[model samples]
Target: MKKLGLILSFAAALLFIACKTNPFTGKQTLALVSNSQIFPMSFQQYNQFLSENKVVKGTAEADMVKRVGQRIAIAAEKYLNANGYQGYLEGYQWDYNLVQDDQVNAWCMPGGKIVVYTGLLPVAQTEAGIAAVMGHEVAHALANHGQQRMSAGMLQQIGAVAGNVIIDDPRTLNAFNQAYGIGTTVGVMLPFSRGHETEADQIGLYLMAIAGYNPDEAANLWLRMKANSGGQEPPEFLSTHPATDSRIANIRKMAPAAKAEAAKFGVTSFK
Candidate 1:
Protein backbone atom coordinates (compact mmCIF):
# COMPACT_ATOMS: atom_id res chain seq x y z
CA MET A 1 0.00 0.00 0.00
CA LYS A 2 2.79 2.40 0.86
CA LYS A 3 4.56 1.64 -2.43
CA LEU A 4 1.32 2.08 -4.35
CA GLY A 5 0.72 5.42 -2.68
CA LEU A 6 4.20 6.63 -3.50
CA ILE A 7 3.87 5.57 -7.12
CA LEU A 8 0.57 7.35 -7.54
CA SER A 9 1.92 10.55 -6.00
CA PHE A 10 5.00 10.44 -8.16
CA ALA A 11 2.97 9.95 -11.32
CA ALA A 12 0.62 12.81 -10.47
CA ALA A 13 3.48 15.20 -9.80
CA LEU A 14 5.31 14.19 -12.95
CA LEU A 15 2.19 14.64 -15.02
CA PHE A 16 1.71 18.13 -13.62
CA ILE A 17 5.15 19.34 -14.63
CA ALA A 18 5.46 17.43 -17.90
CA CYS A 19 2.16 18.49 -19.45
CA LYS A 20 1.91 21.08 -22.22
CA THR A 21 -0.60 22.01 -24.89
CA ASN A 22 -0.17 20.83 -28.44
CA PRO A 23 -0.94 23.87 -30.61
CA PHE A 24 -2.43 21.80 -33.41
CA THR A 25 -4.79 19.80 -31.21
CA GLY A 26 -5.17 22.38 -28.48
CA LYS A 27 -4.95 19.51 -25.99
CA GLN A 28 -2.55 18.88 -23.16
CA THR A 29 0.08 16.18 -23.73
CA LEU A 30 3.01 14.81 -21.80
CA ALA A 31 6.49 16.04 -22.73
CA LEU A 32 8.95 14.62 -20.23
CA VAL A 33 11.82 15.15 -22.67
CA SER A 34 12.56 18.55 -24.17
CA ASN A 35 13.64 19.36 -27.72
CA SER A 36 17.05 20.31 -26.36
CA GLN A 37 17.49 16.77 -25.06
CA ILE A 38 16.04 14.92 -28.08
CA PHE A 39 17.11 16.94 -31.13
CA PRO A 40 20.84 16.23 -30.90
CA MET A 41 20.18 12.52 -30.51
CA SER A 42 17.72 12.63 -33.38
CA PHE A 43 20.23 14.39 -35.60
CA GLN A 44 22.91 11.85 -34.77
CA GLN A 45 20.64 8.91 -35.54
CA TYR A 46 19.47 10.54 -38.79
CA ASN A 47 23.04 11.08 -39.93
CA GLN A 48 23.92 7.49 -39.04
CA PHE A 49 20.93 6.20 -41.02
CA LEU A 50 21.83 8.33 -44.04
CA SER A 51 25.37 6.98 -43.94
CA GLU A 52 24.06 3.42 -44.05
CA ASN A 53 21.31 3.97 -46.64
CA LYS A 54 21.56 4.96 -50.27
CA VAL A 55 20.41 8.56 -49.97
CA VAL A 56 19.41 9.75 -53.41
CA LYS A 57 20.44 13.23 -54.41
CA GLY A 58 20.43 15.53 -57.46
CA THR A 59 17.61 13.57 -59.04
CA ALA A 60 14.13 14.80 -59.97
CA GLU A 61 12.46 12.42 -57.53
CA ALA A 62 14.75 13.50 -54.72
CA ASP A 63 14.15 17.14 -55.60
CA MET A 64 10.41 16.56 -55.39
CA VAL A 65 10.73 15.23 -51.85
CA LYS A 66 12.72 18.26 -50.74
CA ARG A 67 10.34 20.66 -52.41
CA VAL A 68 7.19 19.18 -50.90
CA GLY A 69 8.78 18.98 -47.48
CA GLN A 70 9.74 22.67 -47.59
CA ARG A 71 6.26 23.70 -48.64
CA ILE A 72 4.72 21.63 -45.84
CA ALA A 73 7.11 23.19 -43.33
CA ILE A 74 6.13 26.67 -44.48
CA ALA A 75 2.46 25.83 -44.18
CA ALA A 76 2.98 24.52 -40.66
CA GLU A 77 4.74 27.72 -39.70
CA LYS A 78 2.01 29.85 -41.19
CA TYR A 79 -0.69 28.04 -39.24
CA LEU A 80 1.23 28.20 -35.98
CA ASN A 81 2.12 31.86 -36.35
CA ALA A 82 -1.40 32.92 -37.24
CA ASN A 83 -2.79 31.04 -34.29
CA GLY A 84 -0.74 33.06 -31.76
CA TYR A 85 1.90 30.38 -31.46
CA GLN A 86 4.71 32.26 -33.11
CA GLY A 87 8.24 31.02 -32.35
CA TYR A 88 6.85 27.60 -31.50
CA LEU A 89 9.29 26.07 -33.98
CA GLU A 90 12.47 27.57 -32.61
CA GLY A 91 15.50 25.28 -32.76
CA TYR A 92 13.96 23.15 -35.51
CA GLN A 93 16.67 22.27 -38.02
CA TRP A 94 14.43 21.03 -40.79
CA ASP A 95 16.09 18.51 -43.11
CA TYR A 96 14.51 16.38 -45.81
CA ASN A 97 15.98 13.44 -47.70
CA LEU A 98 14.89 10.69 -50.05
CA VAL A 99 16.40 7.25 -49.58
CA GLN A 100 16.56 4.42 -52.08
CA ASP A 101 14.59 1.81 -50.15
CA ASP A 102 11.87 -0.65 -51.10
CA GLN A 103 9.70 0.02 -48.05
CA VAL A 104 6.69 2.19 -48.65
CA ASN A 105 7.15 4.41 -45.65
CA ALA A 106 8.12 7.90 -44.49
CA TRP A 107 8.83 9.47 -41.12
CA CYS A 108 9.85 12.71 -39.41
CA MET A 109 12.13 12.76 -36.42
CA PRO A 110 11.72 14.98 -33.37
CA GLY A 111 13.48 18.07 -34.74
CA GLY A 112 12.17 18.04 -38.30
CA LYS A 113 14.42 15.41 -39.91
CA ILE A 114 12.33 13.71 -42.60
CA VAL A 115 13.02 10.64 -44.74
CA VAL A 116 10.86 9.36 -47.58
CA TYR A 117 11.62 5.98 -49.08
CA THR A 118 11.66 5.62 -52.87
CA GLY A 119 9.01 2.89 -52.68
CA LEU A 120 6.52 5.43 -51.38
CA LEU A 121 6.72 7.39 -54.63
CA PRO A 122 4.73 4.87 -56.59
CA VAL A 123 1.86 5.03 -54.11
CA ALA A 124 2.00 8.82 -53.92
CA GLN A 125 1.65 8.91 -57.74
CA THR A 126 1.63 12.72 -57.91
CA GLU A 127 2.82 15.87 -56.17
CA ALA A 128 -0.46 16.15 -54.32
CA GLY A 129 -0.08 12.61 -53.04
CA ILE A 130 3.41 13.43 -51.92
CA ALA A 131 2.09 16.42 -50.00
CA ALA A 132 -0.42 14.21 -48.20
CA VAL A 133 2.27 11.82 -46.96
CA MET A 134 4.78 14.56 -46.14
CA GLY A 135 2.17 16.61 -44.38
CA HIS A 136 1.13 13.66 -42.16
CA GLU A 137 4.72 12.86 -41.21
CA VAL A 138 5.48 16.53 -40.49
CA ALA A 139 2.36 16.80 -38.35
CA HIS A 140 3.69 13.99 -36.17
CA ALA A 141 6.82 16.05 -35.56
CA LEU A 142 5.05 19.39 -35.08
CA ALA A 143 2.62 17.95 -32.55
CA ASN A 144 5.48 16.52 -30.48
CA HIS A 145 3.99 13.03 -30.63
CA GLY A 146 7.42 11.46 -30.17
CA GLN A 147 7.97 13.24 -26.88
CA GLN A 148 4.47 12.38 -25.70
CA ARG A 149 4.98 8.73 -26.55
CA MET A 150 8.23 8.64 -24.59
CA SER A 151 6.46 10.15 -21.63
CA ALA A 152 3.64 7.63 -21.86
CA GLY A 153 6.14 4.79 -22.10
CA MET A 154 7.81 5.98 -18.92
CA LEU A 155 4.47 6.08 -17.16
CA GLN A 156 3.65 2.60 -18.34
CA GLN A 157 6.92 1.32 -16.95
CA ILE A 158 6.22 3.01 -13.65
CA GLY A 159 2.84 1.32 -13.52
CA ALA A 160 4.45 -2.07 -14.03
CA VAL A 161 6.84 -1.42 -11.18
CA ALA A 162 3.94 -0.48 -8.98
CA GLY A 163 2.12 -3.65 -9.97
CA ASN A 164 5.06 -5.89 -9.14
CA VAL A 165 5.59 -4.26 -5.79
CA ILE A 166 1.93 -4.43 -4.80
CA ILE A 167 1.28 -8.01 -5.78
CA ASP A 168 3.23 -9.97 -3.15
CA ASP A 169 1.99 -13.54 -3.81
CA PRO A 170 3.87 -15.44 -6.52
CA ARG A 171 0.81 -17.22 -7.98
CA THR A 172 -1.29 -14.03 -7.82
CA LEU A 173 1.59 -12.05 -9.26
CA ASN A 174 1.93 -14.44 -12.19
CA ALA A 175 -1.74 -13.96 -12.97
CA PHE A 176 -1.25 -10.21 -12.81
CA ASN A 177 1.67 -10.36 -15.22
CA GLN A 178 -0.56 -12.08 -17.72
CA ALA A 179 -3.49 -9.75 -17.20
CA TYR A 180 -1.42 -6.58 -17.13
CA GLY A 181 0.15 -7.34 -20.45
CA ILE A 182 -3.18 -7.72 -22.20
CA GLY A 183 -4.89 -4.94 -20.26
CA THR A 184 -2.29 -2.30 -20.95
CA THR A 185 -1.88 -3.18 -24.59
CA VAL A 186 -5.58 -3.33 -25.39
CA GLY A 187 -6.93 -0.83 -22.88
CA VAL A 188 -4.25 1.86 -23.02
CA MET A 189 -1.42 1.59 -25.52
CA LEU A 190 -3.25 0.57 -28.69
CA PRO A 191 -5.95 3.21 -28.29
CA PHE A 192 -3.35 5.85 -27.51
CA SER A 193 -1.41 4.96 -30.63
CA ARG A 194 -4.52 5.05 -32.79
CA GLY A 195 -5.50 8.45 -31.43
CA HIS A 196 -2.16 9.88 -32.45
CA GLU A 197 -2.56 8.57 -35.98
CA THR A 198 -5.98 10.15 -36.34
CA GLU A 199 -4.72 13.46 -35.02
CA ALA A 200 -1.82 13.35 -37.47
CA ASP A 201 -4.23 12.71 -40.31
CA GLN A 202 -6.35 15.72 -39.42
CA ILE A 203 -3.43 18.08 -38.91
CA GLY A 204 -1.75 16.83 -42.06
CA LEU A 205 -4.80 17.54 -44.14
CA TYR A 206 -4.84 21.11 -42.91
CA LEU A 207 -1.18 21.53 -43.72
CA MET A 208 -1.62 20.05 -47.17
CA ALA A 209 -4.51 22.39 -47.86
CA ILE A 210 -2.58 25.43 -46.71
CA ALA A 211 0.34 24.34 -48.89
CA GLY A 212 -1.88 24.48 -52.02
CA TYR A 213 -2.72 20.80 -52.31
CA ASN A 214 -6.29 19.61 -52.20
CA PRO A 215 -6.99 18.01 -48.86
CA ASP A 216 -9.48 15.63 -50.48
CA GLU A 217 -6.53 13.79 -51.91
CA ALA A 218 -5.81 12.54 -48.41
CA ALA A 219 -8.71 10.09 -48.46
CA ASN A 220 -7.81 8.78 -51.88
CA LEU A 221 -4.22 8.42 -50.76
CA TRP A 222 -5.37 6.24 -47.89
CA LEU A 223 -7.49 4.19 -50.29
CA ARG A 224 -4.37 3.49 -52.31
CA MET A 225 -2.55 2.62 -49.12
CA LYS A 226 -5.28 0.13 -48.24
CA ALA A 227 -5.15 -1.42 -51.69
CA ASN A 228 -1.42 -1.76 -51.31
CA SER A 229 -1.88 -3.66 -48.05
CA GLY A 230 -4.06 -6.40 -49.58
CA GLY A 231 -6.58 -6.35 -46.70
CA GLN A 232 -4.35 -8.11 -44.23
CA GLU A 233 -4.15 -6.45 -40.84
CA PRO A 234 -4.75 -7.12 -37.18
CA PRO A 235 -8.10 -6.26 -35.72
CA GLU A 236 -8.60 -2.53 -35.16
CA PHE A 237 -8.91 -2.93 -31.39
CA LEU A 238 -5.55 -4.65 -31.24
CA SER A 239 -3.80 -2.45 -33.79
CA THR A 240 -1.79 0.72 -33.33
CA HIS A 241 -3.52 2.57 -36.21
CA PRO A 242 -7.16 3.12 -37.00
CA ALA A 243 -8.75 0.80 -39.53
CA THR A 244 -8.61 1.89 -43.18
CA ASP A 245 -12.31 2.60 -43.57
CA SER A 246 -12.42 4.73 -40.43
CA ARG A 247 -9.45 6.80 -41.52
CA ILE A 248 -10.84 7.31 -45.02
CA ALA A 249 -14.19 8.45 -43.66
CA ASN A 250 -12.58 10.82 -41.16
CA ILE A 251 -10.37 12.35 -43.86
CA ARG A 252 -13.30 12.93 -46.18
CA LYS A 253 -15.24 14.70 -43.43
CA MET A 254 -12.24 16.84 -42.52
CA ALA A 255 -11.50 18.01 -46.05
CA PRO A 256 -13.92 20.97 -46.03
CA ALA A 257 -12.62 22.22 -42.71
CA ALA A 258 -9.03 21.89 -43.89
CA LYS A 259 -9.78 23.86 -47.04
CA ALA A 260 -11.46 26.49 -44.91
CA GLU A 261 -8.34 26.69 -42.78
CA ALA A 262 -6.32 27.30 -45.94
CA ALA A 263 -8.63 30.12 -47.00
CA LYS A 264 -7.61 32.02 -43.90
CA PHE A 265 -4.08 32.10 -45.33
CA GLY A 266 -5.12 33.45 -48.76
CA VAL A 267 -4.89 29.98 -50.30
CA THR A 268 -8.30 29.68 -51.88
CA SER A 269 -7.22 27.47 -54.74
CA PHE A 270 -5.58 24.06 -54.50
CA LYS A 271 -3.68 22.00 -57.00
Candidate 2:
Protein backbone atom coordinates (compact mmCIF):
# COMPACT_ATOMS: atom_id res chain seq x y z
CA MET A 1 0.00 0.00 0.00
CA LYS A 2 2.82 2.38 0.77
CA LYS A 3 4.50 1.62 -2.55
CA LEU A 4 1.18 2.14 -4.34
CA GLY A 5 0.79 5.49 -2.63
CA LEU A 6 4.27 6.49 -3.71
CA ILE A 7 3.48 5.53 -7.34
CA LEU A 8 0.28 7.57 -7.33
CA SER A 9 2.10 10.58 -5.85
CA PHE A 10 4.75 10.33 -8.56
CA ALA A 11 2.10 10.18 -11.29
CA ALA A 12 0.31 13.18 -9.86
CA ALA A 13 3.53 15.14 -9.78
CA LEU A 14 4.16 14.27 -13.41
CA LEU A 15 0.71 15.57 -14.34
CA PHE A 16 1.35 18.79 -12.50
CA ILE A 17 4.50 19.31 -14.55
CA ALA A 18 2.54 18.82 -17.78
CA CYS A 19 0.66 22.10 -17.38
CA LYS A 20 0.47 24.51 -20.34
CA THR A 21 -0.58 28.10 -20.74
CA ASN A 22 -3.92 28.75 -22.38
CA PRO A 23 -3.52 31.22 -25.24
CA PHE A 24 -6.72 33.17 -24.72
CA THR A 25 -6.41 33.52 -20.94
CA GLY A 26 -2.61 33.25 -20.60
CA LYS A 27 -3.17 31.01 -17.58
CA GLN A 28 -1.25 27.84 -16.81
CA THR A 29 -3.69 24.90 -17.10
CA LEU A 30 -3.52 21.22 -16.51
CA ALA A 31 -3.73 19.16 -19.69
CA LEU A 32 -2.72 15.59 -18.91
CA VAL A 33 -4.78 14.51 -21.89
CA SER A 34 -3.20 15.95 -25.02
CA ASN A 35 -5.14 17.39 -27.95
CA SER A 36 -3.57 14.78 -30.18
CA GLN A 37 -5.55 12.23 -28.18
CA ILE A 38 -8.69 14.27 -27.64
CA PHE A 39 -9.14 15.66 -31.15
CA PRO A 40 -9.29 12.37 -33.04
CA MET A 41 -11.78 11.05 -30.50
CA SER A 42 -13.85 14.18 -30.90
CA PHE A 43 -13.76 13.90 -34.69
CA GLN A 44 -14.96 10.32 -34.56
CA GLN A 45 -17.71 11.19 -32.10
CA TYR A 46 -18.79 14.14 -34.26
CA ASN A 47 -18.98 11.95 -37.31
CA GLN A 48 -21.04 9.43 -35.41
CA PHE A 49 -23.37 12.12 -34.16
CA LEU A 50 -23.97 13.42 -37.66
CA SER A 51 -24.61 9.93 -38.96
CA GLU A 52 -27.18 9.21 -36.26
CA ASN A 53 -28.90 12.57 -36.00
CA LYS A 54 -31.18 14.60 -38.25
CA VAL A 55 -28.66 17.04 -39.68
CA VAL A 56 -30.29 19.96 -41.46
CA LYS A 57 -29.76 20.08 -45.19
CA GLY A 58 -30.51 22.52 -48.04
CA THR A 59 -31.94 25.04 -45.61
CA ALA A 60 -31.12 28.66 -44.91
CA GLU A 61 -30.58 28.12 -41.19
CA ALA A 62 -28.32 25.19 -41.89
CA ASP A 63 -26.28 27.32 -44.25
CA MET A 64 -26.13 30.10 -41.68
CA VAL A 65 -24.62 27.78 -39.03
CA LYS A 66 -21.93 26.68 -41.45
CA ARG A 67 -21.21 30.23 -42.56
CA VAL A 68 -20.93 31.56 -39.04
CA GLY A 69 -18.80 28.60 -38.03
CA GLN A 70 -16.38 29.19 -40.89
CA ARG A 71 -16.07 32.87 -40.16
CA ILE A 72 -15.37 32.23 -36.47
CA ALA A 73 -12.88 29.50 -37.38
CA ILE A 74 -11.04 31.84 -39.71
CA ALA A 75 -10.98 34.48 -37.03
CA ALA A 76 -9.54 31.96 -34.57
CA GLU A 77 -6.80 31.00 -37.01
CA LYS A 78 -5.95 34.62 -37.63
CA TYR A 79 -5.83 35.39 -33.94
CA LEU A 80 -3.59 32.43 -33.14
CA ASN A 81 -1.29 33.11 -36.08
CA ALA A 82 -0.93 36.76 -35.25
CA ASN A 83 -0.04 35.93 -31.66
CA GLY A 84 2.92 33.80 -32.82
CA TYR A 85 1.00 30.60 -32.23
CA GLN A 86 1.04 29.63 -35.88
CA GLY A 87 -0.41 26.27 -36.87
CA TYR A 88 -2.33 26.12 -33.65
CA LEU A 89 -5.30 24.88 -35.62
CA GLU A 90 -3.38 22.77 -38.12
CA GLY A 91 -4.80 19.44 -36.94
CA TYR A 92 -8.28 20.76 -36.30
CA GLN A 93 -10.93 19.26 -38.57
CA TRP A 94 -13.46 22.05 -38.35
CA ASP A 95 -17.01 20.90 -39.08
CA TYR A 96 -20.30 22.52 -38.15
CA ASN A 97 -23.77 21.08 -38.35
CA LEU A 98 -27.27 22.22 -37.51
CA VAL A 99 -29.21 19.51 -35.74
CA GLN A 100 -33.00 19.34 -35.73
CA ASP A 101 -33.37 19.55 -32.00
CA ASP A 102 -35.60 21.79 -29.96
CA GLN A 103 -33.04 22.40 -27.25
CA VAL A 104 -31.40 25.78 -27.42
CA ASN A 105 -27.88 24.50 -27.14
CA ALA A 106 -24.66 24.68 -29.08
CA TRP A 107 -21.29 23.09 -28.41
CA CYS A 108 -17.86 22.85 -29.99
CA MET A 109 -15.91 19.69 -29.38
CA PRO A 110 -12.15 19.59 -29.44
CA GLY A 111 -10.62 19.90 -32.93
CA GLY A 112 -13.46 22.22 -33.99
CA LYS A 113 -16.40 19.84 -34.25
CA ILE A 114 -19.39 22.12 -33.69
CA VAL A 115 -23.11 21.51 -33.53
CA VAL A 116 -25.78 24.17 -33.34
CA TYR A 117 -29.28 23.06 -32.55
CA THR A 118 -32.18 24.40 -34.62
CA GLY A 119 -33.99 25.66 -31.53
CA LEU A 120 -31.28 28.26 -31.02
CA LEU A 121 -31.87 29.86 -34.45
CA PRO A 122 -34.89 31.88 -33.48
CA VAL A 123 -33.02 33.32 -30.51
CA ALA A 124 -30.00 34.06 -32.66
CA GLN A 125 -32.18 36.08 -35.00
CA THR A 126 -29.43 37.33 -37.30
CA GLU A 127 -26.12 36.25 -38.74
CA ALA A 128 -24.25 38.34 -36.22
CA GLY A 129 -26.20 36.92 -33.30
CA ILE A 130 -25.46 33.40 -34.47
CA ALA A 131 -21.84 34.41 -34.77
CA ALA A 132 -21.85 35.45 -31.14
CA VAL A 133 -22.98 32.02 -29.97
CA MET A 134 -20.70 30.15 -32.35
CA GLY A 135 -17.71 32.23 -31.36
CA HIS A 136 -18.33 31.42 -27.70
CA GLU A 137 -18.44 27.68 -28.35
CA VAL A 138 -15.32 27.81 -30.49
CA ALA A 139 -13.49 29.68 -27.78
CA HIS A 140 -14.20 26.86 -25.33
CA ALA A 141 -12.52 24.37 -27.62
CA LEU A 142 -9.56 26.59 -28.36
CA ALA A 143 -9.03 27.16 -24.65
CA ASN A 144 -8.88 23.40 -24.08
CA HIS A 145 -11.38 23.48 -21.24
CA GLY A 146 -12.39 19.88 -21.94
CA GLN A 147 -8.82 18.68 -21.55
CA GLN A 148 -8.47 20.53 -18.30
CA ARG A 149 -11.68 19.04 -16.99
CA MET A 150 -10.50 15.56 -17.88
CA SER A 151 -7.15 16.12 -16.19
CA ALA A 152 -8.87 17.36 -13.07
CA GLY A 153 -11.12 14.31 -13.02
CA MET A 154 -8.10 12.03 -13.27
CA LEU A 155 -6.44 13.72 -10.34
CA GLN A 156 -9.56 13.43 -8.26
CA GLN A 157 -9.80 9.75 -9.08
CA ILE A 158 -6.19 9.23 -8.05
CA GLY A 159 -6.81 10.92 -4.75
CA ALA A 160 -9.91 8.88 -4.06
CA VAL A 161 -8.06 5.65 -4.81
CA ALA A 162 -5.21 6.59 -2.49
CA GLY A 163 -7.65 7.40 0.27
CA ASN A 164 -9.44 4.09 -0.10
CA VAL A 165 -6.17 2.17 -0.06
CA ILE A 166 -4.99 3.89 3.09
CA ILE A 167 -8.30 3.43 4.91
CA ASP A 168 -8.52 -0.28 4.03
CA ASP A 169 -12.23 -0.45 4.75
CA PRO A 170 -14.94 -1.14 2.16
CA ARG A 171 -17.38 1.28 3.80
CA THR A 172 -14.74 3.97 3.90
CA LEU A 173 -13.78 3.25 0.29
CA ASN A 174 -17.41 3.59 -0.78
CA ALA A 175 -17.75 6.86 1.07
CA PHE A 176 -14.56 8.14 -0.48
CA ASN A 177 -15.75 7.29 -3.99
CA GLN A 178 -19.11 8.95 -3.44
CA ALA A 179 -17.62 12.09 -1.99
CA TYR A 180 -14.94 12.35 -4.62
CA GLY A 181 -17.46 11.72 -7.37
CA ILE A 182 -19.72 14.54 -6.28
CA GLY A 183 -16.87 16.86 -5.45
CA THR A 184 -15.25 16.36 -8.82
CA THR A 185 -18.47 16.25 -10.80
CA VAL A 186 -20.55 18.97 -9.22
CA GLY A 187 -18.07 21.16 -7.39
CA VAL A 188 -15.05 21.07 -9.68
CA MET A 189 -16.60 20.30 -13.06
CA LEU A 190 -19.45 22.76 -12.74
CA PRO A 191 -17.19 25.66 -11.84
CA PHE A 192 -14.75 24.71 -14.59
CA SER A 193 -17.60 24.67 -17.07
CA ARG A 194 -18.74 28.06 -15.89
CA GLY A 195 -15.23 29.39 -16.29
CA HIS A 196 -15.14 28.03 -19.83
CA GLU A 197 -18.42 29.79 -20.58
CA THR A 198 -17.07 33.09 -19.30
CA GLU A 199 -13.82 32.71 -21.20
CA ALA A 200 -15.76 31.83 -24.31
CA ASP A 201 -17.89 34.91 -23.89
CA GLN A 202 -14.84 37.15 -23.81
CA ILE A 203 -13.02 35.44 -26.66
CA GLY A 204 -16.18 35.13 -28.74
CA LEU A 205 -16.81 38.83 -28.60
CA TYR A 206 -13.42 39.57 -30.05
CA LEU A 207 -13.75 36.85 -32.67
CA MET A 208 -17.12 38.15 -33.86
CA ALA A 209 -15.73 41.65 -34.03
CA ILE A 210 -12.72 40.53 -36.04
CA ALA A 211 -15.13 38.71 -38.35
CA GLY A 212 -16.95 42.02 -38.89
CA TYR A 213 -19.89 41.49 -36.56
CA ASN A 214 -20.72 44.24 -34.08
CA PRO A 215 -19.68 43.00 -30.68
CA ASP A 216 -22.59 44.83 -29.06
CA GLU A 217 -24.96 42.24 -30.48
CA ALA A 218 -23.46 39.67 -28.14
CA ALA A 219 -25.23 41.18 -25.17
CA ASN A 220 -28.48 41.27 -27.09
CA LEU A 221 -28.05 37.66 -28.00
CA TRP A 222 -27.77 36.78 -24.32
CA LEU A 223 -30.88 38.76 -23.63
CA ARG A 224 -32.65 36.59 -26.13
CA MET A 225 -31.20 33.51 -24.45
CA LYS A 226 -32.42 34.67 -21.10
CA ALA A 227 -35.89 35.15 -22.46
CA ASN A 228 -35.75 31.77 -24.13
CA SER A 229 -34.84 30.15 -20.82
CA GLY A 230 -37.87 31.80 -19.19
CA GLY A 231 -35.59 33.57 -16.72
CA GLN A 232 -34.92 30.45 -14.70
CA GLU A 233 -31.30 29.73 -13.94
CA PRO A 234 -29.23 27.93 -11.34
CA PRO A 235 -27.23 30.04 -8.95
CA GLU A 236 -24.21 31.68 -10.53
CA PHE A 237 -21.77 29.55 -8.54
CA LEU A 238 -23.54 26.27 -9.32
CA SER A 239 -24.29 26.90 -12.97
CA THR A 240 -22.09 26.40 -16.01
CA HIS A 241 -22.38 30.06 -17.03
CA PRO A 242 -22.65 33.41 -15.39
CA ALA A 243 -26.07 34.71 -14.59
CA THR A 244 -27.57 36.27 -17.72
CA ASP A 245 -27.46 39.69 -16.09
CA SER A 246 -23.77 39.38 -15.36
CA ARG A 247 -22.97 38.07 -18.82
CA ILE A 248 -24.83 40.93 -20.47
CA ALA A 249 -23.09 43.45 -18.27
CA ASN A 250 -19.69 41.97 -19.13
CA ILE A 251 -20.42 42.01 -22.83
CA ARG A 252 -21.57 45.60 -22.65
CA LYS A 253 -18.33 46.50 -20.94
CA MET A 254 -16.21 44.74 -23.58
CA ALA A 255 -18.04 45.89 -26.73
CA PRO A 256 -16.16 49.14 -27.24
CA ALA A 257 -12.79 47.45 -26.94
CA ALA A 258 -13.82 44.70 -29.34
CA LYS A 259 -14.90 47.29 -31.87
CA ALA A 260 -11.58 49.03 -31.54
CA GLU A 261 -9.88 45.72 -32.23
CA ALA A 262 -11.99 45.25 -35.34
CA ALA A 263 -11.02 48.70 -36.50
CA LYS A 264 -7.44 47.52 -36.71
CA PHE A 265 -8.61 44.97 -39.32
CA GLY A 266 -10.27 47.75 -41.37
CA VAL A 267 -13.76 46.91 -40.17
CA THR A 268 -15.72 50.05 -39.36
CA SER A 269 -19.15 48.53 -38.98
CA PHE A 270 -21.17 45.38 -39.45
CA LYS A 271 -23.68 46.82 -41.87
Which candidate leads in lDDT? Answer: 1
Clashing residue pair totals per candidate (backbone < 3 A)? 0, 0
lDDT against the true structure, per candidate, is 0.93, 0.86
Pairs of residues at least 3 apart in sequence or in different chains that clash in candidate 2 = none
Per-model TM against the reference: 0.98, 0.92
lDDT of 2 by residue, 1-271 (tens): 8767696977778677879888877899998989999988999989999999999988988898898899888888877887888978878988899999999889999999999999888898999988998988898899898888888777777777677668777887888788878877778778787777788888898899988888999999999999988999988877877899998998899889888877877778883
Q: In the order shown, what is each candidate's alpha-carbon RMSD?
A: 0.9, 2.0
User: Worst lDDT window (10 residues) for model 2?
Assistant: 156-165
TM accuracy, model 2: 0.92
* Stretches of model 1 off by over 4 angstroms after superposition: none
